[model samples]
Target: MAAGAPRVFVSHLSGVAVFDPNGDQVGRVRDLVAMLRVGQRPPRLLGLVVELSTRRRIFLPMTRVTGIESGQVITTGVLNVRRFEQRPTERLVFGELLDRRVTLTETGEEVSVLDLSVQHLPARRDWEIDRVFVRKGRTGSAFRRAKGETLTVEWSAVTGFSLEEQGQGAESLLATFEQLRPADLANVLHHLSPKRRAEVAAALDDDRLADVLEELPEDDQIEILGKLKEERAADVLEAMDPDDAADLLSELPEDDKERLLNLMQPSEAADVRRLMSYEEHTAGGLMTTEPIILRPDATVADALARVRSADLSPALAAQVYVCRPPDDTPTGKYLGTVHFQRLLRDPPYTLVSAIIDDDLQPLDPNATLQLIAGFFATYDMVAAPVVDETGSLLGAVTVDDVLDHMLPEDWRETEFHLDESDEADEDNEEVAAHDS
Candidate 1:
């Protein structure tokens, strides 16, 4: 069937029906699902789930579904009913793949399949298999196997199907923000409009929201924060990196900022405030308060213990910073950073400094956005330390923050620009003076 063929409605179909490709009766369609809002048209058919024997179900993709005849449905592919009916260790074959990694040939990158697309096939009176699309990242660009791309065989691939389990998992979506590559997340966010960005953020839980927020640009952070309810906004901010939280707060109106800060827990609010106290363009302002700081004398085992207790960001670098006692020059007199990957192979009792990288590329407090962008491009650094003139650590600026300043014109609204033009016209008195 042509891709753009006009859609047809199935007649005499009171509800959904399910059948195998070989024309075996499976189950009946329960409902047609869609996203409908006020002023929006009724939800279109996306896909259907057939309730087979013993509560087993299969998703029929909308693309492969043709048309429905009287009491019969047509499908594009042939499926064995027994393969879908066998029970695997996991209750549902589809559910077992949730959160599992899959690679897409189009991008030659791996992504987690977030959600499966299902649609009703009226011709077969059954659901048909659709292309399996993977969630690319939080920004919502999905990775689909291009036409004719061979599916690579892996232990994770579904070979023989089973039907023992017949229900959905707690969270049926496969891919999540934490599982996405930072670069992919950035790409996705850059492409999303403010409204779409809000919808995506609203769909995520707090933790997932925090993960994506940390990877997004500052303007995006501000835009998304503006759209969320005060409580949800506060929750997401509280869960974000301290430096990121501070940057976002700085961009918000004073009243909104204060309100959100007040809504946060005492500890989280304090951390944000401390970060905010620094100048906006300074290193102190950019450094995250959540860094894994440890004593120079601490052993690998001790550092590992601290890591376990701390709520480390998922995108943490391979290194951990070694610090002196809490003092005015705590970060200025930094010992070094221990490479985390090395620690895994080294003795547990090894001193942290023994594995530290003293030549870390640190940021200066007065650095400009352009300069930061240069650093990000040159060093390919995910995170960099920011320090004051006194050599004291202020905060850290990350690649995501730098990218925020480089956003394309479409990312922000033009209302302010239009207002400026209006003001300039009003200020020009020559035309008015001539008229007078």
Candidate 2:
């Protein structure tokens, strides 16, 4: 540790927004870069690996950093703007140091590194590890009743162990990512090499992995899905939003797609199948089959309960569909929807049908993308129900899905966006979360 040098924990640096001199966010710090040194010297801070709005990873040298405060990293406005590529001698602090196993000098008790604090060198253009935050616990200790206490010690007091020989390569990295939001985790996964991405993906649970997969680009989606065993891949797909699952399946070979779908639970598979049957540009294809649905007789309390379920997506939870019988698809008959706001304004025991939005016309499953777009614009709705020819409720097409479909292909891979609709959808999710 150097006197008069600014310090920040590596964990705090992860996902911190990087702003230019004008206070405009240029990107987010995905990882910190450092060059491993000889002897007992700590690795020298090289720069930061930042991911831009376009999802490109670029390097920003530490020398360019002018300030670090208030959850943001300020830069000198001067940037390389070049893609980041790890050199042979460099190591990522978050990717390699955090969650790694190390031995405490005093007790000789092994601990897993939880975080690292780095300090800028005084009167120099460099930074070095100052402290190591380590947790005293064995593998899978998180599930145990008694948790380990984390300790912060000088970096020299701990010795790093090799994860590869411990039969847990990248497991530590994946564990750290478990705390990040799905979108942030997806960004981290996207920056990794193909092999590393697959390893981390394999380590995540089906639901978490599915969330990250939905955030990833279509090509990356297929690549990671292909790496999983058929059964696990099916589970991940089943956990994803039906529309997203269908879109991914649509990109796969027919035989492979069918095989994965068959491995899913029949109810889930049926929903995905119905979605896949629709043309890519149709409302059905853009809809999610898992919206909150209830019988017309269901109470406002019931609707509220459904909306509050953690499993439902924000768009799906925004409204409740009131149908006839057979609550699942075909949903018996297309009745009407009751917005969450309506539920909140009514008495708890009141029937949902009593306050349903009868004037809200449902989109036909065969409705074209343009027609669906017009329907959203006309109704000013965040989501709308899709019905079959017999007036059976199929699913609900969300505004976000429609926006994604309208974007040009390869939008995720390109720097120039067709529009900021995706970003707007992200904002909508945040607002919905707060409202809920």
Candidate 3:
């Protein structure tokens, strides 16, 4: 089913007869399983908790379901007879999500989650609960059907939350600040009550949480990381920049740090482990393993293309490290740096090797924080390459990391305020001036 296809509300699927590709009745969809994601992104529809003829329930993954039309689910005849065991990440839609009281972002009026509409994402087997069918009245058991002020809105429109008090959801709180920068979001997380903070953090996707984790104070990082399931914690750490991930891990007890590292993908774990081996304030410790690395033969255009990635921080993108054969850090013999400006000035076909700034001295991995800061200050450079004794590029240290280390510990503790009134006033004044 396409994303644009009509969404089937979970209420309509209660006990919906599921059939095989040959049109034989397999079972009925007792409940839909969904895995909630971080932030306001929709929860993924994992599969159906189908009760077979033998009265044994099994999980039929969305991948196995080819179609859900005419009130019948068509499966690929590949059903896992194993009992449906809900993982820590899975939520049974009928059991947990429905009939919850949530609020509208616009009016802040509470509504009952009568049903959730799941949609098949375009060109993929994945499905997600994209809309919430709610009624502006009292709440009760899940899947309660009633008529009064009924309307279906995007999932975001509901007062999303899983609160210890009342029924406000974490997604509701996060939706209010969805556009915040990671640092700003970290500030919001920092000031929240511990329980609320963890809930909010848990709702964020791994990559986003990783970005926020990097900005948070060490204490906050530890607290939040501890609250997450180990598997998820490892995943979040893997998503973070290697240097940042290492720093967070180092704050944990040795046992915990090692456990998470082992759970991470081997390559990602290796990078974090290598970074942790360095002195906390040294170039090796501060340099990110995933810098823009290009070979000597790579064209200026190639270097430019790598630099333009939205994933890279501005400081990291400010230059490309030209190394020899092994492109992965610690890359083969370090050649020299090619600044972004240089890439722009040269023709696209020009070799990055021909315009190398070899005269610039690269920092040793063991270079001190003060030394790294001095190097950046002296050259007016946003980033610098870190080379080892073997003339290999260990990684590149961006100025942001240098400043992060050099700044006072309390710098990140400053309270964040989103005051747009001044900007609004300025805009009004400018408008008035223009009108006059």
Candidate 4:
């Protein structure tokens, strides 16, 4: 522990209310961010991930933090609205380090890691681990059960919690990545050793693993998929979006792809196969077969309910396709689509066919990527339907799927950049301007 520094346990820091210099409540601290340092040096505290009124999680760098006491934090009164995005080297202290198992050097007994303490280094702007709070033993007497005793020990007294130890196959380690975005999780998985990556992949549920796989680079996707059992891999594939599944399957060897496809449900396999038949860069190739579709006679109320589903993406939810007869595809006759704006404007009992956007034209299955891009640019649509030669609605291509094909492979890292210091300065100026 650094000398003459106030000691604060991480548990006490979680959920602490943050206030500005004027003593106005800003938000609550959600998590502490830290950068893992090399060698015997303690990890450096980076900042705090704070949840504001809008439920947006944003970063508040330690540089702007003025005080930490009495279950409250005082800031420099500068607030940023943008959400926090984790950098490659950073880790969340509350999510990852707490509730883990560590070895006590003197006792050689494994104890449940309960909480962590960090201290500001003397005369320096750095915060480092000072002590570890651990549960010593099972607090129980035969029939009566109770909580264990807690002990705060020097940071040096614990073992098995270094950067290298993070990969030692503990299920507890995965808790850290749970709150991260799929893209961010994919980046963390990419940096892990092959064995550790497989362990983490196995630990994640099908839906989460599917989301992460879609965000990963193709080679990484294939490698992780290869690690799973054939049956489990198929299940994960089924959970993924049809377009992403087809794209990944298209990258595999024919035999491997066939074997996995054979394991999928007939309906899912059919959707993927339909997508695979088209050229990889064509509308047919990029479209998702499971788009929202409604019969022409369906009521706007019914359409609105389907749109309310949490599973639907913003782009897919923006509109619903109106077709004839069979609710499922091959939707008999391709009628015009109904945009969400129309759905809202009309009464609930109104038929969908009445408000269809006749101005929007559906794309042919054979349309090239360039043509599809132009169509989206010209129509300003988030998603456009794909129709077969007979005018049967096949699926819709979302703008996101198009960007997936168009952007460079490394575009994930380059898409957005936010600097903490710049955000703080902007907020300070905004506060100053408002006062004047």
TM-score of 4: 0.73
Clashes of each: 31, 0, 10, 0
TM-score of each: 0.48, 0.80, 0.61, 0.73
Those runs of model 2 whose alpha carbons end farther than 4 Å from true positions after fitting are 1-8, 17-27, 38-41, 51-58, 66-89, 97-114, 130-175, 415-436
| Candidate 4 local lDDT, 1-436, one digit each (tens) | 2357478877777567899999999888877888766654677787788866544567887767878977899988876665577666777776556655678889898776767888888788667776888876542222233366778887778776753454333243454445667876786677555766787788788998999999998888999999999999999999999999999999999999999999999999999999999999999999988888998789999999999999888999999999887757657898989999989999999999888987767999999999999999988889999999998999999999998889887665342444556445556542322222
lDDT of 2: 0.79
Error of 2 at 293 (Å): 1.8
TM-score of 2: 0.80
> Each candidate's lDDT (Cα)?
0.53, 0.79, 0.79, 0.79
Residue range with the least summed lDDT across 10 consecutive positions in model 4: 137-146
Q: What CA root-mean-square deviation does each model show from the true structure?
A: 19.3, 7.7, 19.2, 7.9
Between prediction 1 and prediction 2, the one with superior lDDT is 2
Clashing pairs for model 2 are: none
lDDT of 3 by residue, 188-247 (tens): 577555866776787788999999999999999999999999999999999999999998
Ten residues in a row with the worst lDDT in model 3?
A: 427-436
Candidate 1 off by > 4 Å: 1-209, 212-233, 277-285, 305-315, 327-332, 373-380, 407-436
Q: What does candidate 2 score in Cα RMSD to the true structure?
A: 7.7
